[model samples]
Target chain A: MLERTKKSFLTALWILIITFPLMGLKTVFTGEQAEVGIRADAFYLAGVVFLCGMMWSMKGLIGRGIAFAVPPAKSCTGAIKTSVMKVPVWCWQVGILAMLCAFPFMGSEAELNKYFSFLIETLIYVSLALGLNIMVGMVGLLVLGYAAFFGIGAYTYAILSLNFHVPFWPSLFIGGAIAGVIGILLGIPSIRLRGDYLAIVTLGFGEIVRFVLKNEAAVTGGEQGLPNQHIPGAIAAPSLGFMVLDREIHYYYIAIVIMVLVVFVVHRLNNSRTGRAWIAIREDETAAMSMGINTFRMKILAFAISAFIAGFVGVFYAARMNFVNPEAFRFEYSVLILSMVILGGMGSVPGVILGAVILQVIPWLMRDMMPNLLREYFPSAANVAGTLTDFRLLIFGGIMVIMMIFRPQGIIGNARRKIELGVEEERD
Target chain B: MFQHIVDGTTQGAIYALIALGYTLVYGILGMINFAHGEVYMIGAYIGIISLAVFTATGMTLISLPLCVFVAFLAALFFCAAYGYTIEKTAYRPLRQAHILAPLISAIGMSTFLQNYVMLAHGKDKFDFPGIFRAAFINNTVQISGARVNYLEIFIIAASLVTMLCLHLMIRYTRIGKAMRATAQDKKMAGLVGININRVIPFTFIVGSALAAIAGVMVSMYVGATKFDDGYMAGMKAFTAAVLGGIGNITGTMLGGFILGLAESMGIWLISSDYKDAYSFILLLIVLIVRPRGLLGEQVSDRA
Candidate 1:
């Protein structure tokens, strides 16, 4: 306990020093004259850091997580989770389908549209994260520029549907096709380069794509995004559902259909011959080649399939939003999706979906819903939470770093992937 | 043409300085310091903040060069401190984890630093004060019938001098020799009684100091900077590092010059709006044609 206190104190002090330049120093200007003064938040930040340093998450949770490679995988909530998992798979699926079907009716009529949009957005990310899982988890190739393909998909729909007068249905598949072809083209160049080098290339590619979208003012509509991005006759589609549905409700169901389709396809692909080939390549490229597994083709197939899902989803995203902008597809978005895959349980479908939902819905709740709910009961806590919501990115960054150090296997890591990582547990 | 050359060389010098950080860390750790760009960014913020603080203190009236010198020192100290603290907290723990882990953490670190700066420093771009205006120095110099900014010349000359000092330090100093040994083989270097822990932190400090230098120079050159400015500059510098052979020092400098030249020339030939794409295109061509980079490579291929 004394040691923990000492460490936390030092960490807090160190944070104060590192943050002095930006946090402690404030240049306030009165007309033409300026003064350098210290702000009051330094103490607040120090207190938070000190408190967090001694918290169980810093030791017990992170320590247990790191040591998870050793079986048992015991935690406070682990038993409940295992019990839930023990229930038959089809039973869980039916339960989830019923819940999803009932989701639209769960809220007030006025707020139903907002919930639908939120769930739709979450579903879109679920599809995107699954695609990333194929590359990062299954193939063991980190594509840092996944957002570029997503942008290409969105743009393909916007341009095809808007300028060429293509309808929503063809534009959707064509978007995926174009992105998939480009994914193949991108894969060939970086095929020989492994690990970090591949990451940089993909990162560069993502930026290059974004720059092209921004620079090509005529077609992409530049910084303002594509003009009239709404999918023509999207509301009028599947006429049966359209009759009973509000427009937002229709988009919500469409998003669910896409997500379900993605989950199904990905699940099938996971058990197929090609899936085995990918797992082999990921395990050992040379060994896979020795086994006549054709590592190159399998790797390319992963890229093509991953990009296709992103493109297909991008069309849906554009259709739902009714506007597509270059800003919507940035490197941060790629990283966000990557984090979802990593956080959920990289190679696991249910885990990725759960991860996507947790990351997306929690942030939204923190920002919009929870604070308002808390305002009625604990006003002080609500203020702290509101302030925290403002620093969401900082907390995200901190959690990511802390999580990687403590639990590289993810919260619900795949059994196979855990072996692949084979991280040595650290002792304090 | 002359102007572009001058501009390219000036920008290239800065790239070389930042790329050295990437190359140096990649050399020692075998993982790209994704937050190296964030370090450069923080350096810029610190450099500008220190400049603002110094200007408010009445130090500029006493001796202008001393003011600039003091600002540089402040930036160096804080940047090195940041590099040391970040590595100790974030990267050190993941040394045994998967390769992808460190990269993700770095991305998170990058995001955190950007937002931290945005929150504390405010989102608006800070204008770098005109240092030359205080002194009676001519802001421009005539070179081969072309008027070049004195700041550009200063940036180039300053970086070259710093690089020379770095080369000397690496060749002569005991710690430098240890770093070289560590880079070659960590286990062997450890066996030879070198303190690998000290060497790793030292590498980060030296690299961050170089980035600090570049950050100060670029802020002066650009006249203004924002919280997110480091992302693009960092990417370009990382490309420059890879182009020169990611783990090589001299090659990184050469790569920086070539990349800068490509960007300027590409801008002159194509539209200026697509200048950011030029570095990426150059990277692609290099990766395809000569993956080892222009300098061949120092680190063994991981695969």
Candidate 2:
């Protein structure tokens, strides 16, 4: 009993020592002016310290008591797997297609525009996530600077279209090719490195790309960024007025078609011999190399292909937004895309798409739909919902933390990743 | 050239301070504490408030040096608690989880903290009151056509003192021995009866305290700080850590100084518009030329 008391006492004391100085310092020193006097602020400081001490002690006690409980598995992988396996793939595809095709027709014009915008955004991420999955999910490379390719793709089309009056159709290939070349350049240097080192190196490349884009005013339009990005007018289609790519509906359809094409290619690749080689390298590079696989070429192939897909979507992104800016390609955006791939289930195509849609669509729905509903039923609550929108990123960060902790395998756990993560757990 | 060197040294000191935090944490845990930057950010905010408290209490009652010491200590204390809690909440549970889990958690914590600070302190930049506004600090000493401010001298001196103290502690202390043992091998350390849990959090506390000192000095040096200041500073410091060979304390210090000088000189040679790019380019160069870093021992693939 005495020992426990002594331990708790020590814990509280340590907490007190650490908490008082930093917390009190802030209240005492306002930046420009002294707002609250020291004597007045002393109580607040003391209260905070006491609270911290109490919390620390409680944690010590409660945490010990709870330590014996078996931890729940991080994700409902088994449950999801069983349910997903029960559904036939064709039914799932046809039903999804039917719903997507009928989406715009069901909503009011204003609602249709909003829904189309969301769908277009979703499609863009779906393509981006799928591309990233090739490197991160299949190749097992954590590419931290993925948005650099996205940036490259956008900038390529923007520069080509704006400068030479090149149309969007050809620019897409050019942008993808440019990004693919850059990806190879990055991948070659990174081939020697693994894990976090490669992650940082790629991150550095991404930043360099951003800086160059921001600095080269002559070509990239400097910080003002390339505005009024030109995309080709849509081709005439049966039963549709001259489909203008700038219009939301036409762009949405084009994006959907591209997204489908990407998914198909990715699915085909995931089942091919090359895909197996990539996964083998991901599992053990040395083993893969020893097995007569050219690990270097395959790794670079993953980078090139992934970057191509990113670049492909980049042209579409520029067209959809009708604007291209350095801000669109920040490190944060890369992390967000990576998070989508991770949360959905790394290496799972359907999982990543599900992850992207859930992350991207839910926030908008919460911000736009929730407040309107609340404002009608409970007017006062609407103001609270409005303020909650500001915390979207905060919630995203929380989700990332929670998801990683609870279910590192993600929403749709791949068989390989599940085994790997499981092996990791038993080692400790 | 002399001016750039002096500026670089001051900048280098801050980077060294931040780099040490990364190195210490990395040494103990293979995971990168991505939220370390946000911890520094929190420290700076706390430093601002602590300064306000000290000023409100009236500095006339005590010597200026004592008042300054008190303010720094206060900031360090609170930042230590923050570091402790951060590890407890974000990292501790993931200790045995997948490798990527901790990294993702750290990123999430960073994102959360950045936005949290933004909500607490408005998005705009806040002017950090120049407590050293006295002639002693503002006065410039010219040496060989180079103008050096006394504040720069103070910054360098404080950084050196902190680093020296850390060096002494790590070299001689029992806790330091335990930390080294644990870092060398956690399971073996546990077998040797060393408390891994305690050592880990203690390492966090010490790293955080160092970061807090850096945060205060930086806010004072720059004259203004924004909520987003930590991101750039953290990345540069992380670069320094990697350049020096991650987990090598001495290497981190040397790396920080070299990076600072390179950045300063690079900005002078090229346009300052690409100032952020300079460090990243240097990082890439270092990565390609010598992946292990200058002082880093060869670390084979753990797999």
On DockQ, the leading prediction is: 1
* Candidate 1: CAPRI quality band: medium
- Angstrom error of the Cα, residue B256, model 2: value is 0.7
Name the candidate that leads on TM-score. Answer: 1
Model 1 lDDT per residue over B1-303, tens place: 888888899889999999999999998888878788888888888887887787688776787777778888989999999999888878888777766677777877888888888888778987777663324235687888878766777888999999999988988999999999998888889999999999999999999999998998888788777889888889899999988888888999998989998999998888799888898888888888876778855344442
User: Compared with the real two-chain complex, what DockQ does model 2 have?
Assistant: 0.51
Prediction-by-prediction clash tally = 0, 16
DockQ of candidate 1, scored on C-alphas against the true complex (2 decimals)? 0.56
Which whole-number lDDT from 0 to 100 does residue B150 have in model 1?
65
Worst 10 residues of 2 chain A by lDDT: A232-241
After the best TM-score superposition of candidate 1, give how far the Cα of residue A151 lies from its true spot, in angstroms. Answer: 1.5
For candidate 1, the lDDT comes to: 0.82
* TM-score to true structure, per model: 0.92, 0.89
